[model samples]
Target: MSVIIRKSLLELIFSGAFMKRWNDKLRPMELVEVDKQGHKMIVAWLLFLLNSKGMDVARKRALGESIIEGGIYDYLYRLIITDIKPPVFYRIKENPDDYRTLSNWVLDQLKPRIMPLGEGFMRGMSEYLMQPEDKGLARRILNAAHLYASYSEFKLLKSINTMDHELTEIEDSFVSRLEALRDLKGVSELLNENDNVLGRFARMCGRLRYQKRWSQTPRVPETSVLGHMFIVASYSWFFSMEVGACRARCQNNFFSGLFHDLPELLTRDIISPVKGASQEIGDLIHEYENIELERVVLTPLRDGGYAEIADRLEYFLGLEVGSEFKATINRDGEVIEASDAKLAGEYNLDTLDPKDGPLLKVSDSIAAYIEAHTALKNGISSDQLHQALYRIQQTYKEKPVIAGVQVSALLADFD
Candidate 1:
């Protein structure tokens, strides 16, 4: 099915950046919807990685699709409800007729904007939203991830809110809810263990929420590196559908976009201008990033028996093939680079475990452009933002198509 792609749809997804998480409580740093969603997805994937030891590709794909689609639905619903307390929302959900009415309204609002994602996506969203009692493994994983992400944020605020009575209650609630999921395959193993590998890795990703993007310039609804990654991941998924990417290619692109700047978690967000100062400086920074990435992320995962996870991450980052922006695939344990044309043609099979690196680059750039453009639209302009937008547009101006999508035309739509 052909789906329309437009500015409003992408902007709708980006709007999550402005939706503050835990609005009623005091936070050491701002916790926004985008960052929370990003962290949740990361945790979900981490849990999925370990728990899905013997699952078939089809089942994995279905569950993965559910996680992604369910997340989108959750975000959209949260946006409409606008800071309703969980208890109150639960009350609303308890009334089947009322819940159905409310959910349908949400789908109505989302349909026009998200219909472009395709009929199946909207159908999944509607079905998932209307049926609130989904007890599948995918749902369990999402539930576990949700509590983990929220609990991680609670830790950040716990230091300052030590005396607040409600803080203790919230903490207990999070623990109880998470403990309830101990029945789930990997939840107990990881969460029950002290300073376990998955816990450490998830916490590392949570820290990305603190690393703000565009550090050199101020912008309205400031986005963190974590939030930016989520946007890129989201865009990559939608674009993958738009271009008819294979299952593995779509999965690879989404995850690659998700973790593209993960190295920045250690080094912080390095502005492009500083990196672009000289070729040597850029190379030095790249070299340093790889060193730190291996030492901190890969080494720990490998040591903890999550080497497959580590290796897959390395592949997504294109550690062996060069820049993460280069198209590549894994065939019988060998990392082979390919062109966008080949990815769309010969290497589209799932067994190749292909990743569309160039398409992922386009997703990354378009996400940045949207960030700058949104900031300007929100009336918090700076030369940095303007220059960033201009540079992206100029870069794509001569290229009408990129990774099977109309890159120049899409950029022109924003004009």
Candidate 2:
């Protein structure tokens, strides 16, 4: 039963024309990239989670300031507009007052394309313990995330001269709208906090554009850490949905995918071969990454009263969680004892493990295969990429199933 659900969601994500736009073109950054919209959508979801944490603060501050009745909506609007492409973006910019018109128009274009998966994910999430209002909010955030994810790569292209002018204008427009809402109490503070956290994350993602993937291969467009994270998260979501993950489990998988490589933000992307050199060296690098993650990301969020956020990050990166191999599924297709079971169960699924930690591992491999396969299709010859594609193919050759879903079939679809 869960496999059927997962299969449908996976198909939906892949078949959506909106998502196809990203698949159709390589990312603008001089290197080949995969699934730009998919990546942005994942980040948008992350931002939504972060925003949810501070919603109480936001509501109190908004009421105190009395700037407008819908300050929170405005704030989200501003964050979302950053992902809108030109023409539509310019149309929105020109009318500003007609934001509703532009927003509606944009939705008209995207809702049919992406909303089914969005709604399905939400329904799957319904098994979690959240207020009805929160579920509604989550739906809205997911919708916005889906739209923004498709366009976010453009923002990263600003560093390249050819794309600088248009990207700058789009960014300027986003900034101007943000500034207009700066006067709302907590708005400025919240934006600053987001900038400190998410902004830094975004910039770190940009640096990945320059980091070459499969460096051993002949020339290939670089797959930055940022783009990789997005693909991982997107792939993870598909797997999670296939497994009939509850809202909390799905959220855990998605976020874990998004931040799995956050340590790379500080250390730069240390290639796998280097880490695989020796267990001692690999352990040392892992230790260093953990230390940096704690010092750079976790501790700061904890001090800022976002201990939950910090904990989530730790869990996603396998910092505090034990080995993922411990995760298992029951004959009934339910998670039995996942590494993150205790935490995942806190939100719901008290008797069943969420298995998100292990699921994320599978998604990570799938994303890697897609990267290599896409590169090969573009005629970039590389022994490493070809090897990677072969290794992944062989590894999952025998219908590798996880949490009751046949992941091999998912991978086979691409082949």
Candidate 3:
């Protein structure tokens, strides 16, 4: 029963939309290639969090010296530089004071798209880890992350010029309407402060471009783990849209999918075959990931008093939950109790079931299928690729739906 549920969930995580993310080209280079930006942004955000010690120190100094909070300024700066789309950014650059107003407008547009998942994870931090006084700070950080995740895709879209000319023009005009506010005195002061942390983190994320995915697959374009996460997150958002998921559910699915492979940063991309080599081996790998994640990722943040950020990562990555498949099902195929229930009972009462585990599983499988499919299309014949494609298709042969998504139809589109 658990196997069935796990299988279904994997299928959702690898859904066609997720896979298509890999195919989405990014550029500004000689090579006609780049991995999806959505995944890259997830890694970027994680890096930002990991490298935020300097920012935290700066914020502390500001508070002690009776200076205004520099944290908010740092947040805005990072968001503008990292996630703000080119079309909108050009406008924001022209008028920095309107940054607050324009940012809200941009977020509104991104709400139905990819920001919700990041938003949910941010909100999770405030709810679970932070003190009341720090909740506002948590929210500001969330806004930054959310904005980055949303606009991250535009880097690729603009590079490839994928959208129609008319649509591009419309987007440009829409952002240009906001008049430039001349005075940015407060913002300017904040911006003048040192931002070594942000710079270091941004550079670290940039290195992911060199950390190629599917290293064994020949004749395939190089993909970075960073890019893959963005794609998965975006795909999860699209899948949520397709299934008419509630706002909260959509956020959960997007974030869960976005950070699903985060442990790979410390562990590298440990391929599935090695993980599935044996039950004991799989369990051991999982154990190692948990340990490394805590040591290399979560512990430093917690020690630095950014426990909220660490907690949010654990939640989104399923570290806190133990299993990616959150629901317990019996042989009769009824949910006995979901992981969320256990969480709510143990933690905050406001905690709600994300109901996205199954969807994430499907998205995962779809992503795998597309990777195999793309390899095959490139004439890179590998037994593993062929078998993976066949296995996924075979597994879903009679499975028509999971989490309200038409499984058969989704697979058929790939066919």
Candidate 4:
């Protein structure tokens, strides 16, 4: 593809009428005219509004303001005026209610609108949005779409009825944290309340898989992070129960599994090569992430009045503030001897001990096998399947902890 096509596509992604015109695959010059011009005009108008001072000054000014300031304000303003197109602003000054519905309709129209973006762009966007001193119009866009609300707004909107509004001193505390996550934009899109707990749990599992390894796959059928979460959560629940675990453990494991990858919402899933770089490089990335989480995740949670929610999540993960370290504990308490019929043994605390480690490990492995198997079933080469099988078997062989179990057989059974 030419640079013009690439540039036009980038411009089209942010265009209001993009969906209407997208299938045409119009000429690069036409695309440039439509998308680029529209963006520039809209951004220019916003810059004039924000920084042009009085009306007389605004009208007389011929020269444009800085694109940076204007672009930022335009993005923020668009968020506040979600669904209300630039055209509507001209007509709705007199009818707020009609404009409100029109605005909502516009956003609803975009909800089903999906876009396929590269992992590089996705991660960049996440990092860009997660800054503490951040100013993102997209987040505001999400908020205006009613995908998110302040904690108080959520409380009012949800009518959360309960005698005890605050967390009891002895309660798990994570419950409050989970409650805080209730109103985040894109979160509900990711989680499900209509589905049974197992169903909801499954969604979380799918997300974890996507977070760890999205680029390895050629294409993501449903490209949103939320969609990926839903699938993984389902598989995790199914495999967990199949392994003879009880309902509660499975649910907790499933939830933990889902949330295990939540940070990726901010970090984006860093591929293995970039992540496995030199110690200094890795540490630098880690440090950058620490800064971002504090700015993006932590502060947002606080501003949203769900500080307790963030606190609980950190506690559950056994992590402290200002650090990205997460603890994943094994299921079945301590590591047990593979041959020991009693299945009891020493507890290993010197390593990662996240609550969902074992379950996530199993879920992750099963998902890989299932994905590869599905591909083969759909006519992926036998050679490809064999390669996947080799990797799966080797992984099981190396991970002595999981080798004792029947994970490979379970995946094969599914196949």
Candidate 4: misplaced stretches above 4 Å?
1-213, 220-224, 239-248, 277-287, 315-354, 380-389, 400-405
Q: Which candidate has the top score in lDDT?
A: 1
* Most TM-score-accurate candidate: 1
Clashes of 3: 27
Sequence-dependent TM-score of model 4:
0.39
The TM-scores, one per candidate, come to 0.96, 0.63, 0.54, 0.39
Ranked by lDDT, the better of candidates 3 and 4 is 3
Give every collision pair in model 2: 6-242, 37-149, 37-150, 40-149, 41-149, 125-247, 208-224
For residue 153, give model 4's deviation from the true position in Å.
21
Q: For every candidate structure, what is the RMSD over all alpha carbons to the true structure, in angstroms?
A: 1.5, 8.8, 12.7, 21.7
The better candidate by lDDT, 1 or 2, is 1
Report the C-alpha lDDT of model 4 over 182-282, residue by residue, as the tens digit.
44333443234234332232232233322334455543221233323323443444444344433333443444433444556557877535776687887
Candidate 2, 211-243: lDDT as tens digits: 555655653334556556655665676566555
In model 1, state the lDDT of residue 135.
91
Write candidate 3's Cα lDDT for 1-415 as tens digits. 0001122333232332223321233534321112323433443344334434456544532221111112222222333234444456657646746655654554443334233334543343223322222433333333333333333343335655665454466445433321121021111111221343332233334344445567776535445666566445655655665655544455556667667777776678787788899999999989999998888667865775557567666767666457654532222323233543332233212124344666677777776676677668768888878888888888788676766556666677666
User: Candidate 4, residue 406: CA error in Å?
Assistant: 2.1
